[model samples]
Target: MNSLTRWVRGPWTNPTASGLLIALAAIFSFTEGVNPFSDGHAEGAGALPAALIASDLLMVAAAVVAGTPILIKAVRALMTKMIAIDLLVSVAAIGAVVIGQYWEAAAVTFLFAIGHALEARTMKKTRSALAELVAVAPDVAVVMRDGKQVEIPAAGVEPDETVLVKNGAKVPVDGVVIGGTGALDESSITGESIPVEKGEGDEVFAGTISGGGFLQVRATGTGADTTLARIIHRVEEAQDAKAATQTFMEKFSAWYTPGIIVLALVAGLVTGDAVLALTLLVIGCPGALVVSIPVAIVAGIGRGAKDGILIKGGEYLETSARISAVALDKTGTLTEGKPYLTDVTVLDPALDRSDVLGWAARAEAGSEHPLARPIIDAAEAEGLPVHGLPERTEPVVGMGVIATLDGQRVSVGNLPLLTVEGIADDSGAATEVDRLAGLGRTPMVVTLDSRVIGVVAVADRIRSDAQEMIARLHDAGVQKVVMLTGDTQRVADAVAAQVGLDEVRAQLLPEDKLTMVAQLKADGYTVAMVGDGVNDAPALATADIGVAMGAAGTGVAIETADIALMQDDLLKLPQAVDLARRTVNVMRQNIAIALITVVLLLAGVFAGGVTMAIGMLVHEASVLLVIVNAMRLMRRNEDQHSAGPAPASDARELQTAGAGPLS
Candidate 1:
């Protein structure tokens, strides 16, 4: 009894079942040779056969079944003082029935009922991409407490708790690996297909799957504070937000529906043709125009989330489509931020490479300078003996270090420091320094008291994908890609040459980057600045769009950057720009479809061939077409993760077709 009541109150009330019943009634009415019901007009009711009476009753019963929901919705909308499409549909269906057009009323309501159900089902699929992210969130956790492993809800794990993750288990929190080793499939967080190896001190994120090995993670964030939670939240908010085009369409639809009603009333009063007026009302529902932009935005944003690109909202997606110039912060954006020792040259006749390295390491011992560790690590890597630090050391800002060793003076820095200390480099030290700088290295000339001994150099590693990213940016329609760095001109130029960058501005301060961005805007270019989000904050804020890479862990990065890539992958940059352009293209196409559909529909209604039933059929078909068109965005671009760039010919075709980026 309970199950029957539930069924009666559920699917039976949905109107889809009513559509099925109406379909059966139509089959019996349309072909009088088959089934018990027969078609007949109401003009000769007294002389009607049993078949004719039964057929009319069957059509009327199906009409009531399908029209009840429309009538109820119309009443609710009227109570709120709103003129909804449901009200228009209800009035049209009732007028058809009053005129003894049972076949027309039944067909109109059945088509609407089935269309609504199909629309609801397809729309749910558009949101499923983001829903998959929320579904991957860890539900269970195993934490080590008081020497015992305790199982609990993932949210119950407190901050700083040491959680144990084994092979094939989902990581339950955002944390640092404290012990053990593992390879994790981090695709859920980063969208990278490969498994990343994690050891002690490596960072891990929630919702990542452990592929092999075990790990002890010290949790820093759990539950709602995890990166997975933040991504899901951002995507949900973005899908709900409206674009400017969507807002305008909604405003137009609000007035369009009412105008249709007024037009229908006027036509009926002028021509004294009730049927013609009812057909106009049915066709002028604004069904397609109302949904065009919103569906596109939802599908587009949700697709981006699945690929680990987080757009802030519809507004940002629209703005990104106009990007013509992009500036990158050199240290972390195009190169690995960590400096590594690349070269060491010995110029002194008395000492070899080991002697020079040992002296540099001893002087740099106990130093906190950024370049010190690379030199020290390189010295240790060569199995050199590095003892105690110099008794006293002084680091000159932007020059080098000055230190005092036993009974002597030792210095390691640039040639500027040599000149500042009144030490002359007569053994072609200047030539050697220039040679190292030419190779993109920051050379430090080490001097033992007054003698120039050797020069040791360190440089940040260029990312393997740097050149590919540059090429892809051009393929995506970016006019310029500039690299901004605080390094010397030689080092910056070397990197720019290797990466094929269009422009390189070297030796720039943080404020200087902001000035460059503003200059791009002044030149009529829409700019995007990719940076680490700290020193580049001003420049990022000044540009039309700011993109942050490796943003999975930082809340500010995910929230503030216009486009946040969950992983530190350069390929994602071009993919993001291409996606924004494609989404904007889809939005424009949908609007065109909606407008053209309405115009053609209006023309058909006045041409006298379109009846009430036919108008409703076309109206539902147009709404479905708009929705299905938006769903195309939900499909993954297979070439998005491929190594190659989009074809130049493809871009040219898009431009010619008028279906490319907005600008």
Candidate 2:
């Protein structure tokens, strides 16, 4: 019995079946001298003939084949005391058939069925990005167990287990490399096509493909616990959640279907015209209204996902479009989070460059500050002797570090540490600090036996694309670009000038950064705060939109940020803003198209020019149009606006003004 029911309902779901039925019905109607396009005026010319009996039988078969699903769905809805578009369509088609309008009945049901099939097909295309993501989910894992390679289901791998990733293989779990080296094509997670080099201690995500080279990774997360899983979960949730406009449209549709039925009954009773009543019911299917917002939201969000930009939901997309000011953290956002040794000034010409650098490297050998890496790395690179850790080390909370090496007191820190240590600057060390600061370098004064020796400076390199990103933001309609940092005023000013930031807030603690974001919101500016998502959590939460950069490897950032950029590229930021604006525009345009179609169709029905068949055709056409309009978002290159390059004079002026504050 179940097989029989499936066979019966299959024709209703297939567009080819409906098309064949419509073709057969047209042939029979033409041979019997019944004009299917007469708009229901054939009632006067119709006559029963023995030869025309075949045409009536064919029309009845066409109606049954095309209307079965609608009738079944309407019956189910009626059992639940709900009125839907299917119920209205079923009533109209069945009523036309009962009133002896065979051509009208066949045309209405066949057109409705074919239209629904087309809508479903086009709607799937709008969601193709998400479908592609699901298709790429890893299935198998190669693990090293009992000293032998074992193949198992990806979900069966235990945490902390060693997994072997081979060339051109999909990584089965999120893990940290423990041995060997390779480049990974992280496009699945980060949307970057360039392969990223990975080595010992570098994190790799599941679903990424290893480019050439072997690697032994210690699994940190497996199955649904991986970052890829979180991104997939978030994207599915975002697509399923309803926007405010969608909620309104759903409620309106609920009332619309029932209201159409009531209007049809009243018009039939008062005017005594059954054709007019059925025509009203046919036109009021709510076809376009029900799908307008969801189609646009799905397409827009899916497009973002394909590009490695994960927007939280439709509501966030709407908010991102109105962003006027963008707040960026200086250290990890605008500048490379890693600092490098950029300048070395010898205050005492008597001491050589190695002597000055060796002392600073020795003092910093025991410290683990971010700025310490560049100094240590430079010392090691130049073959300076930094053999072992210092004997004793004390970190001054806000200043620097004091280390005792071989019972010799060595202090390396800013001028504040010198003041606290009572070291006089009669050697003109302060002059060197100011000069390095003017160039955007973090200057540290090295002291030995309470005497200033030399100054060592480390500066965070400005990203090559930083200026271009800021310029693109301006082109994307951003009113102001501001830099918020905890660095000293002079250092912040220099970096800000180099990047062309309109405003700079330096020496900010974490709480101070949060307050600055709140102040911007209070000032009525729609602000978007971009950060690395760890130390900047508070400010990120306070801003209108929190953007997490390079979030593919971090689960927390993927779940928390309003917008997560999978890669660490500054250019994706402006691309996200542009996408959001374009998506919201599409949503608004779709809604307008849907509503306008309904009003015009309703007006045509009352004017007595539209028949039941014509109304269904027009209604179906509008739904297809709305879906096609949303599909426009699936194509990249919707908006080609980009901030090309910064002018040389503008860059020079910023550098000049930026240097003045530090000098």
Q: Name the best candidate (by lDDT).
A: 2
Residue 467 in candidate 2 has what lDDT?
A: 84
What is the clash count of model 1?
A: 0
Q: Per-residue lDDT for 296-362 in model 1, tens only?
A: 8888888888888999888889889889999998887777677777777999999999988888887
Q: Model 2 scores what on Cα lDDT?
A: 0.82
The models' CA-based lDDT, in order, is 0.81, 0.82
**lDDT of candidate 1 vs native?**
0.81
| lDDT (C-alpha) at residue 186 in model 2 | 85
Regions of model 2 farther than 4 Å from truth: 1-14, 39-47, 75-82, 638-663
lDDT of 2 at 641: 32
True lDDT of residue 187, candidate 2: 80
